[model samples]
Target: MPFMEFVNFYLMPGIVLGSIYALGAVGITLVFGILRFAHLAHGDLATLGAFAALGVVTIFGVSPWVALPVAMVACAFMAIGIDKLFYDYLSERPKIIVVMSSLGIALMLRAVVQVVWGVDTETYTRGIVRPDDYWGIRIRDREIYTIIAMFLIVGVLWAFLQKTKWGKAMRAMSDNPDLALLSGVDNRKITMLTWGIVGVLCAASGFFLGINTELKPLMGWTMLLPMFAAAILGGVGRVEGAVIGGLIVGIAEETSVLFIPGEYKAAMAFAILLLILLVRPTGLLKGKVL
Candidate 1:
């Protein structure tokens, strides 16, 4: 393929993949910064959100856009419930305990999805979607939607953190939980708020991933490595850093095929993770150290 063709095909898709990863990473970062846990179940929650959307779309015969909100709300509630059931009691314990709980949650969630949706691969819509060309470059509608959604979602979140009272409360809690609590920041309320945002982000990520490809029980699980890589790369507590890290990881994964075998493509995130931890443990944006 020609240079621009290569760029158009590889780089553009990378951005879309990055956007999905960023969405999931932002959620991971939020939970980490606020609750101080690794949240291994984050990707599985995304999978639940996607399958929720699929169910809504199938049952109601509604557009995917319409089902987005439904799935987000559903997942948000599920996240809150999960916190109450599992993480709440362990809150006072070592955060590692919660991390192990999250892995269990991940397995439970994947099993739930498999039980409900079956193990078969499913698509949001039938028929092939041809890409639309612009200035000799082609892009799919879903890919465009993914990019736009990521920016809008994360941009509004940043603005919220900068402008809103609850946003400040959340940030204060992240910066210093004991101090924030002493200063009248309601820990319960802030914890719930973080989970809500994380839930919505997971839904968006899973929805986009499903739209871009096909949905299976393990899809979100497969995405966990890159999503965590993005979160770590961007800096654990910095949201914007997640976006940049996600893009870098996404682009690297795509472009690496030029130099390495495609079968090992998923290993790209693993390599990036190790390199960053070895050199700059904080991340590209000087985020919180793990």
Candidate 2:
């Protein structure tokens, strides 16, 4: 294949897909780092967010872009509610309990989505959109938006973590919860705030994924493996590492179709996950070990 063709068909799609995965992985990493549990319901939460946006679009008759923030806010509240109702009580128990509860939550959320949105596939807009050619490369406006939005969201998060008092408090809790409590950091507020951020990231990721392709009841569930792989690959606690890992996984999955059957592309994430766990458990950025 030609260079531009390869770039257009494989590399560009991979980058866009990677951006979506990066958003979810960042949320996953944050939860692992601070909350100290694997949120098995994350992907389903993302599905809820996407459907939330669809609701806004269908009910309010607004552009999908306008619905983005609405969906984010809705998901934020939902995430907090879930924590308060389910995860909060299990805080003192073994982490495995919380993880298993999350799996239950995942099933509940998926069921809700199916009931509300039905099992039909959906799109933000009707009709097919053609890719615009730039030089020899072809890309869509939504693809560009997905990449830009991912960076903008992550950049703002990075700044908040580095500069703001609350952000620092969150980091402190992640590093040493007892020490942070001794320092008078409000643990409950920080936990709420982290879930809010994670919710927004989840919504953004799902919205982008829906816009780029199509939204189905199982779309986010299908992405769970890749998103988890990206988080583990990048290193459990490192934001930057998650982004890099997402890109690598996305590119590898897309490129794998060239050498292997397309149906086997999903296995690439499993392979990467296994490889990372065995070779360097600390991750590329030397993050905290699981």
Candidate 3:
């Protein structure tokens, strides 16, 4: 294969997929960091956000750009509501039990999605997959936009956590919830805010993933393992770790097709995760421990 052909076929797709995984991983990591639970429902939250965006698009017949924000807002509220109902009650329980509750929540949300949208796959645009070239890249416009969006979002998030008061509070809580509470951090409000940010990120991640491929109820769930792997590889609770881990996982999986079957590509992430754990379980970035 020509060098440029390899770049187009392999490099660009890896970056694009990495961006999506980064977005999804960041959300998972944040929840694990601040909320102190694995939050299996996060995948379904991504699915919920995509469907929410789809609903907005169907109702207003607007561009995805317009529908995305509206959907994120809706999902953010839904996340807060989920916290108020399910998580709040179990806040004092053993962390593993809460994780199990999240799994139950995931199943319920999946059932709800099936009931509302049915098991059929759907998309916002009939001709959404427009092939486009940029510089020398053979990619869809959506792919380019998604990658750029991921960088911008992650940058803004880093700035927020590093420079803002609320961000500091979040970090403090993540570092030590007891200390944070003693220092007057409103744990409940912080929890709500964490879910809101996660909800928005989940929406964006789901939207990009669905647009890049097809939207199915189980799609987010399938991505969950890879997303988790990225989080662990980058270091759980570390935002930058998620981004780096995502890129590495993306590249590793895609490039492995040179030796392994494409069907086994997903397993590469797990392999990487295991190796990373054996070496430095805290993650490459040395993020805070749960």
Candidate 4:
């Protein structure tokens, strides 16, 4: 294929997909770094968020873009509720138990999505969107928006973490919960805040995925492996690392189609995950080891 064809078909789509994966990966990293547990329900939460936006669009007859924030807020509360009702009580228990609970939560969340939205595949809009040509490169407006939005959201988060008092507290907790608590960091509040942020990220990730492709009940579940691969590859605690890892995974999966069958593309993430775990478990950025 010509360079432009490769760029238009493979690279551009990869980047857009990477942006979505990065959003979800950041949430995973945060939970691992601070909460110290694998949130198996994270992708299902994304699915719930996507369907929440669908609900907003259906009932309010609003633009999907407009419904984005609403879905984010709703999911945020839902995440907090889940933490309080399920995970919070298990805080003192073994991490494995919490991880298993998260797996169960994942199933419950998926069930809720199926019951509420039905199993049919759906799309936000009914019409086809044509890609605009930019100097021989073809890209859709939504793809542009997806990439830009991912950067903006992550950038704001980075700024908050580096600049704000609460952000510092969260970082401190992640680094040393015992020390942070000794210093009066208020662990409960921080945990709630983390879940809120995770929920927002989940919604944004799901919304972008839905807009770029069609929405299915299993869509976010299918994405779970890739998102986890991005998180682990990037390093568990490094936000910027997650973004880079997501891009690499996305590009590798897309480009692999040239050498391997498309049906096996998903295996790329698994391969990367194993290689990273074996070679550099600390991740590309030397993040905290699991």
The lDDT per prediction is 0.93, 0.93, 0.87, 0.92
Residue pairs in collision within model 3? none
- Model 2, residue 78: displacement in angstroms? 0.5
lDDT of 4 at 32: 92
Candidate 1 lDDT tens digits, 1-290: 79887878789988889999999999999998889889999999999999999999999999999999999999999999999899999998999999999999999999999999999999899999999988887998888889999999999999999899999999998888899999999999989889989999999999999999999999999999999999999999999999999999998898889889999999999999999999998999988875
Clash totals for all candidate models: 1, 0, 0, 0
RMSD of 1: 0.8
lDDT string for model 3 (54-117, tens) is 8888888998788888978988898889889988899888898889999999999888889999
- For model 3, the superposed segments whose C-alpha errors exceed 4 Å read 128-130
Off by over 4 Å in 4: none
Q: What TM-score, computed on C-alpha atoms, does each candidate reach?
A: 0.99, 0.99, 0.96, 0.99
Could you tell me how far off, in angstroms, the CA of residue 190 lies in candidate 4 after the best superposition? 0.6
The superposed Cα distance between candidate 1 and the true structure at residue 122, in angstroms, equals 0.3
Cα RMSD, each candidate: 0.8, 0.8, 1.4, 0.7
Per-residue lDDT tens digits of candidate 2, residues 131-160?
999998899999999999999999999999
Q: Which residue pairs does candidate 1 place in steric collision?
A: 234-241
